[model samples]
Structure formats: C-alpha cells, structure tokens
Target: MARPKDDDPDMFRIIVATDIHLGYMEKDPARGNDSLVSFEEILEIASKNNADFVLLGGDLFHENKPSRRTLHGCMALLRKYCMGDKPIQYEFLSDQSVNFDHCQFPTLNYDDPNLNISMPVLSIHGNHDDPTGQGNLCSLDILHTAGLVNYFGKTSNLEKIQLSPLLFQKGTTKVCLYGLGSVRDERLHRMFVHKNVTMLRPKENQEDWFNMFVVHQNRSKHSATNYIPEQFLDDFLDLIIWGHEHECRIDPEWNGIQNFYVSQPGSSVATSLSEGETVKKHIGLLQIKGKDFMMKKIPLETVRPFYMEDIVLGETSLNPDDHNVLKKVEAFCTEKVETLLDKAAMEHTGNRKQPTKALIRLRIDYTGFEPFSIHRFGQKFVDRVANPKDLVLFHRRKAGVKKEESGADNELLAKIRPQSLDSARVEDMVRDYFGQVEETSKLQLLTEKGMGDAVKEYVDKEEREAISELVKYQLQKTQDHLKVRNASEDRIDKEVTHYREERKKRKEEDEEVAEALKRAHSMRSQSEDHPCDDDRMSLDSDEESRTTRGRGRGRGSRSRGAKETTRGRGSRGGRGSRGGRGQMKEPVIATNGNRSILDAFASSSSSASQRSARGGNKRKTYSGMDMSDDDDVVTIDDEDPFDISSSSRKQKSQRKTTSRRGVAFDSDSDDDIIPLPKRRR
Candidate 1:
C-alpha cells in the first residue's frame, strides 16, 4: 500500500546510490583515505544539482561495523558537504534548496536536522551490513550522525512495513515506494521469518500507484525453481530498483513485462565485486524528466585488486635458497608488506596524534607454497611491518598444533579438522584442530587416564560385502581354466611312469644277453682237454661247460662266439675284428623314438660293420675262432618269438641307413653279416 501523504515523486529529484562496500579491504589506503570518499563525491554532485533526497540501496560497509577511525572519517565528510557545514551547501544557494540544521551521530539513532538539508540520505541494509533487530549492528548509527540520512526502517526485528495506500504525491502523480531488505543472519538473504518478510499477500487488495520495490538479493528473473519463490515481487511494480545486483543494468525486459523498469545501481565505491558471480562495479543516478525517468551510470574507479600468484615448489628447489625461487618470493613478500605500510603512512597526514582519514585493511593470499618458509615469513612480517589495517595469516603453519601420527612406524592418527590434502596444509589444519580437541579431551577426561568418551571409532562397513561379491565373480569366470591345468598335470605323471617301466625291462634283457655271450666266448677260446682240468684249473665253471660242449658241437660253439661279439658292442654290436681277422660289430645308442627301433638299428648297423671287416686284409685266426653260434642270431630273427620289428630281418634291413649314426650301409649273407668273435685274455 502507498500513502499519498508520504512524499511526492514528481516534485522531488531522487538519486539512488548503492553497494558502497565502504570498508572494502582492496580499496583501502589508496582511494583518498577510504572507499567512503566516493560517497562524499556523490554528495557534492547532488548539491550542484539541488537534489531533494538520496536513497542508498545497501552494503555501505565491507564489514558490518566499520573500524572506529574509518567510521569517523565517513561521518566527518558527510557533516562537511552533505550537511550545513560545507562551503558549497550555502554559498551557491540563493534558494536554500535543502534545510540542514539538525544532525546526530553520537548515541541515538533518532532523526536530526541534516535530514532536511541538501538531499536527505535514506538507506536499507544489504548482506554485508546484516542488520539485526537487536543492537548488534546497523547502518542507522552512521547515517544519524551527519543528519544526512532518515527513516531507519523497522529493522530491529526481521519485519516488513506496509505502505498506507498512497506514497509521495505530486500535483497529479503519486509514487509509492515499497522497501524490502535482508534479515539478520540469514545466509544470502534466504529463510527470512514469515512474520517479518511478507507484505499484503492478498493480491487483489495490493495498492495501485507508481510502485518502487527495493530488495537486496539476486534478481528474481532467473528460473523460478532455484531460489525461494516468495522472494519474487512481480505484482504491479512500476519502477523496481533491485539493490543487491552489483552490475549496472536497465533491462526493461528483465521484469517480464513492458513499462517495468528494474534498475541496479551497482556499487558507490569502485571495488572489485564478484567476478565469479558476474557482478560489475558501478553507481547509479536517476534523472527524471516528466512522465519518463532517465538513468545515468557512474563507475567507481577500483583500486588495484589483491594480487594472487602461484609458485610451484620443485624437488631441486624445495629447500629455500638465497637467489633461487625463495629469494624472489621473499622480495615479493617484502614489497607487499611495504605497500601496506606505505598505505597506512599516507593516510590522515599532519594529524594531532593520530589520523582523521584513517587506514583500514590489507590482505595477501599465499597458496601452493612450502610450509617451512611460509611459517618463517609470517612470523617475521608480522613482527616487522608497521601500522597495518588488519593482518590475516591464511597459510598453514604449525599453529599451536598436535602431531597426528606419533611414531616411527608411520601410523596415521585422526585429527579434528582435516587439511586440504595439500602437503602440510591439511596436516596443519588437522594439527590446529587436534590441539583444540586435545584440550577438550583433557578437560573431559580430567579424572581418568583412559581416552574417555571423546574418541571417534573406525569401522569398515563395506569390506565384507565387497569381498563376497569379488570372490563369487572370480569362481564363476575361472573354474574351466582350473580344470584344464589339473588334466595337464595328470598326463605328465603318466608319461614319467611309463618311461621308468620301459627302462627296467631293457636293463633285465641286457644282463641275460651279456651272460649268454660270456659262456659262448669261452667255448670258442679253449680246447676240449682244458675242461678235463675244470676242477683243478683257473677256468670258470660256465667256461668249462662251454669248452666241453665245444668239443661235442664245434659249429654251435662258433655261432655262440658271433652272438658274443654282437652283444658286446654298444647295445647289440658285433665285436670288431680283435686282431683284424674278421668283420666287427659297430657302435649304436638311442637318440629318440622307440627303444625297439634303436635295437633294430643297432643289430643292422653291427651286421654292416661285420661285412666290411671280413672283407678287410686281417683274416688269419678265423680257422680256430668259434664265432658260429654268435653268427646264428640272424637265423634267430627269422624264427624269433617277439613279433616286433626288432626281431625281424626285413625291418632290420630296412633300417640300413640311420640318422642315429653316420655308419655306412652294407649287405652280407646272414652268416657273413655277423663276424666270428675272438677269445678275450
């Protein structure tokens, strides 16, 4: 509702300046004492134009309660130019355009004479000022001092005021102004109490006139789902000065209808606003001509912003050096310290004892640096630098810390506030919290030595289920491969067992063959008379038997000698001519394939060598040597009990040439194939 008796819109010239952010840390010591200097400049601009009243939309201080000296400087400036105390306020005024006699700043927040002078300054709170209904903090305290500001909207409680159906009245035009601002401690102006934050919600009974609604928040033109829907005031707003936006925009379309003007006056001081949130720094002046109101924008020049730099620490340079990265960093820190010190020195020059303009703040950000140097620098800079606005050390230093892991075994101990996972930083933060928590721990367990009730326990909630799932999957996928491996191992065991059995059978056959050959050789070597002395001589029993048999069967004894030569060679080799008298048996050994195949090759090979040796010149002792029985093995092959190729003559002949040996092949009659065996000494 708009009250017609309030103030006329057409008769008065209105200037809206907003978002001053006066105690801004970035602009301090550079912008003519403080950021409030821009406010004084605006007042001078208002006086030349003979404005009626000035409306400051919000955020007058970077801090809720400015520092005492910066606060006094602001009051002193407004008293001089904004009230009756200025040289231009009365000097160029033939028609005392504004009355400026009453003013107050000391204790009370009541109205003063300066409210009537120059253009009265009216203000509403923004987030930075966070106006509490209690005596915690307010812009009213500062505004009351110079008598330049009026109407401390009932901000003591987070409550909204209703207009009386009529606002300021002109000769025919009446302008209704509706004000809404942030309540105390609500984050970003959300969650205001229902009792203090709503106007006449009965939409049909909402007052009609030139309505001006001022609020300190994001423009409600974004999608309706993100922010609180009740905060949107789209009901018949003629001129809406959306105060919280820090960018200068006069978009008529942003209000969702024609003839709806939403004006954002940006900032009264040129300070860096939120770049990430996309709000620019600007101030707004409203110039009304007839039925139409025109707007002009003034940009507050920003002082140099806070410089942020990242220097990487390397393995080679992690240890601090004189001219290396550490030295450059030191020089940078020293320059920043000097810059802040110089700033403080330049303020309120030629003072009685202290400064009138007063200095406020300096901030430096240190990120991505090693902790050892940062700690040393933080201590040294604080001790050495003079007269700073406010010094904040943000980097991680061992700030009254406690060690997390206490032993050489590298065990991790839990701390209160974990660091940023950056080396030493998170540890440092944890250390700080640990010390605090440890103090609390001691107090809580003062009577006992136990850890008491303060320790937070560790539990692995996911381990059992995760292990079960993993094992189940593995069994499902790999069972077939496991079976294949078992089968391969079984085959290898069978092959090894077969080889050992074959080797034993071959060893027994070799012993019988050797024994038979020994008896046969003795029969061929001795005479029949030698057996007459068998009981009295050096002759072996088998040899005596063989010698007696030789006299009985001469051909049989000789054939036995040939068999001896065959067996005595490597495997079944015929003995080579002992004195070059006859063909000899050759040597043979197993390479691979069947054992029978090797025996056949050996038997055949021996036959070939015997033929060659019989053809040679040495044939003298052949008359007496009884190698006949040994020679009969070829006849045995033709009638052998074994059906294998080993005991067959045709197969033995087929194996005439073998890769098993380089023995040359030769053919001989069965008798000529094996040579006569000689007697051993």
Candidate 2:
C-alpha cells in the first residue's frame, strides 16, 4: 500500500488550501460565481501539480448549510478532479482499532473498490460550517456520505476520547493525518485546559510514521492566543497546516519547536477586497520527505481584478457643476480601470487565465464638490469602463475633506493644548486641596458637639453647625456600640426562660401521651394471651351499642377494663406472656365496608385527645413492638388488599373502643401491623 521509495522521492506531495468560501458572492450576481470559479482553478492546479492529496483548512462553504445551488456546484467541481479512473482501493492502517458507526453520514463507498476517489479531499468544518447541533450533519457530511471527500475530527462517539486519524503510506513514511475542526474561542480555551482535552497520541509505530496536524482556526500574530499555541502542538505534530486565517504564510520551522513546519495557504479567492486580501491569492504546494519538507506558494489566477482609484483634488476650488472638474474625475476612473485590465491580461498570458471583468472603487475627495454631483460624475465614467455590467463602484470622502467636515483638527488641538494647565497653577491648586483635607483630618471642631458659638468666632455659623452635626453622629454611633455590648446578658436570660418553660410543658405532655399508649398496648397483649373469639365479638357489640347511645365509654368502664387486663396478665405471669401469646387466636377479619366506618370513629376520638393536650391533631402509627425488619417478613404484592395506614388505624381503634366498653379487646391484627418509622442511624 506504499508508494515506492526506490529513488528517494518526496515522502508526500500535499496541496494545502483553505477558506474557499463558496457562495461568498451570492449578493453580487455578476461576480458572485467568482469564488466558485477560483475554487475550480485551485482544483485544476492540484491536478496539474499531481498533488498526492488535498487538505482543506475550513470554511469550505460560506454558510453552515449552503444553498442547493451552491452545494451542487461545489460537488460537480470536486467530482471532476477527484473521481478517479477506478474505485478507491485503500485500507486504513488503524481500521481494526477504530469504528465509523457513529458517523451520521458514513460513506458507503469508503472501501468500495468499484468507486474511485483520487487525491481524496480531507477537510475539517470551519466556523461558517461548524454549526451548533449538527456535529455530524453539516454540508461536509453530505459530500462525505457521497464518497466525494474524507471528513475527520468529529467526536460524536461516546466510546472514543480522541479522534482517530486518517492513515496513509507513501514509501518509507507512513502518514498519520489528524484534524480538529474549528471551535469557538471560549470553547477551544476549555479544550486547551490541562487534562481537559484528550489529544491524539502516537501508537506503537510512532518512530516509523510522520504526523501532520490540520486545523481550521484563527492564527493571526496579534491574537495568536486565540489559537492553539504552536509550541504546544509541536509535542506531537511534525507539520501543522492551519486554515481560517485568510492570509498565506509559512514558517519553515517554528522557532520554538524544532523540525516542525507550519503553513497557512490563505484563501483561493478574495472574499473581501480588503488591503490584506488585495495581495496575490495563493495555495501551498508541500513536498515532504522523512523529516524534511519544502513549501512553495503557488499564485491563483482566477481572481477578478480589483481597481481602487483615489482621486485627490488640488486647491483649485473645483465646483461640482464645472464640466472640467467632472471630466477630471471621469478620466481618473477610466485610466485606473484600463491599467488593471492590462495587468490582469499580462498575468493570465500563460496557462492560468484571469477573469476579464474588473471591480472599480472610486474615492472622490474635494472641498467644493457635492457628494451627489460627484457620484453622478463617477457613474458616468464607470459606465464607459470595458465591462460596465461587471464594474462595482465605491465612493468615499478624502482625508482632508473628512477632517474639515468633522473639525477633528480643532478637537485634536484642544486635547493636546499645553496652555490649559500651567505647572505652577496646578501645583498650587493641588496643594490647597490637600491642605483642606489635612486640616479636616486633624480638626478639633469636629469633636465638639456644641461648638456653634466657639467656632462662629473663626468661621461661619453654617460651618459650626456642620462640625456639630459630625460630632453628634460620632457620639450616637459610640452609644449604639455600648448598648449592643450591654444587652448580651439580658438577651441570654430571656432565651433561657423561654426554653425552660417550653421544656416543662413538653415533658408533662409526653408523660400523658406515654400513659395513654401504655394502656392501649397492655390491653392488646392481654387479649392476645387469652384467645376468646366470643369475648372479642361481645366487646365490639358493647362499644357499638354505647357509641350509638351518644354516650362514650364511662370513666368507670375504662378503669374496670384496665384492672381486668392487669389481672389476666398476673394470672398467666411469664408463662402467659411468652408461650400463651405465641399461640393466640387470629382476629376476626373486617371487610372494607365495616373497617371504614370503625376507622373513622377511631381517628376522630384519637385526634380529639391529641388536639386538647398538644394543641395539634398529630396522628402517629404506633407499633407496640420494635419490628425493624418486619418488611422482610410481610410480602406486599401489587394485588395486596391491605393498606398499612387504614389497617393500622382500624386495629388501634378497635382495641381502644373495646377497652373503653369495660371489656378485653385483644386481636392478632397487631402481629401483622406495619413497622414504625426507623430512627436515624
């Protein structure tokens, strides 16, 4: 899979270009296709030079999602030069260790031997194309899916931390090409943080391969920090091809990093007629050997000639209505247009042919000529240009005229006026101001509260009052500080009294609640020890009859039931508490129809007592015994009929109601009861 090194030829022949910016001229219908045309020329240059492959920096499209027309046009040009005579017959060196399933638009023809792809275009998405949300759904994805190009550097797969490179072999040099698509400045900063980014590292054959890093990012000298520093990149890259910056430059070897060549191939077309872009546009032709490389700047001839004519008027007081003055402006434009056309003709005399149309920008600067009249004059001359339809006009005021209109010169003089502040006067004023500050800092008058009479002898009554006010404020602040310090003992005593009274009331209430619960639990334990199904029913009937008569159980009945439960426990003693309790009879189950009515009265009665004693109706589910692991014993299925809240309430009410009726109310229902809430560990 390697190109022969028998003759020791360059290890790789690469064509690096970027910022094609297709559709840049969408607004300029006449010249809008200029960017696309220049891009076609760049491809031709790559083909003519027999470049091994092409590396596009970014901004291949001017928009994140280009128009259908732009996309089709760009694809047609790429297919012309890139579609090979036969299908591609290459295998990735790291295919076994990588996966492309995460690619949203993976190429079906990536390994299709019947589909030929030559000088495969490898590109990263630029700012214009690198949009949010469409990590793998951008315009480039469309081309990649069609097998027109190879797009790398997207980390869509969660399984991978770093982007795997596209590998190729040419003679003794194994090329490992990696790319990082353009990212916003702030996001990129986070990527550059220590341990934040997972950069591509060399594998087992590091010494045998030469690595090239391709990136689309701003790399201007002034804001170089916005880009990944060259020194930082040199740790892994043998060469760096940068894009996004529309200026062509080359550093044979970045001074800080040895053996690392950095190249910027600028843009193929003039996206703007800016001063920097006005220079000859170029692409880089890189010839790389094992560790040595050479970069040649090849000029692109598809650019439309741009003519910027600056016509400065002399101090002859030219009038806009003057035919002579109009003629003078017209002549300047005609001369400049002709000069550019001739120059374009000469440069395209060889293989490359420049566009015939020219962009003419006229800047008229004069004191007397009105802008409207001068514009009309410029248009007349522009109409006569070789190709008026292709001519673009621009107008501007000259520097001198602009200055006169704005009065900037006068403003400048005012800003730099040395006569505004004399050194002696400034010194005296500064001294006087500081003298007043010093006098105020050490003023004895400020300490005197009633200094109105004494200070009036030397100053005005108003000044004396001002000093007295200052003294009064200081005195008040001091008094407030003392008051806060002296109030600590009184505040502590009040807090202690409030908490002591609250604790005493809480203790009394807790004891009453504990006694009531103890009686309820003892009745249930006594009932469990004596299994009497007939007795349980008798108790229920008596309680129901008593409640129906509108007479709750008499206090004598509660006392008699409590005595009987105690007597039962004493008669059985330890034998009844243990063995007898274990063999207790199961309680009579109440149907939903009957349980709801019984539970209602229980809740009302319990809540009444709690409200009267604690001033709050706080109901609690009380399990007589500790059942921390009770959940492990009771199985609750989806179809379980028992709801813990209602069941616990029904059982508690049944026992209390029966006991109030001067009868034993014992049941086995408490054994299947829900466990209490566990205390914090």
What lDDT does candidate 1 reach at residue 166?
A: 18
- Tell me the deviation in Å of residue 90 in model 1: 20
Each candidate structure's TM-score, on Cα atoms with residue i matched to residue i, is 0.38, 0.51
What's model 2's TM-score? 0.51
Per-residue C-alpha lDDT of model 2 across residues 1-681, encoded as one tens digit per residue: 123332354357778888989987666655678778888988988888777778898889987668888899999999898887643333356562252444554543446565676767878888777633213367877787777877767554222247567777665667777887876443454356543555555567687677788888656433434456665554666778888777556434464545566787777766654444545678887766675566777877777665555565543345567767656655655666667666656655254456665555544455455333434444554533333542434444545544343578678877761211101222234335445676445333122212322232113111222333334543454345446656465575454444434434443322222233334344445555666544444344334333222112222111333211111211122321311111112223333322333342233232234334434434321122122322111111111229887666555645543433222234434444333332353
lDDT of each: 0.41, 0.54
TM-score of 1: 0.38
Top candidate when judged by lDDT against the true structure: 2
Tens digits of per-residue lDDT for model 1 on 265-377? 76654343222112334555554422455555654433222222223333223344443755765666556566755654553234342223222222333344533354555
Q: Tell me the spans in candidate 2 whose CA falls farther than 4 Å from its real position.
A: 1-10, 86-91, 96-102, 105-110, 133-136, 156-163, 193-195, 221-232, 250-253, 257-259, 307-334, 350-353, 362-378, 381-681
Give the clash count for each candidate.
32, 2
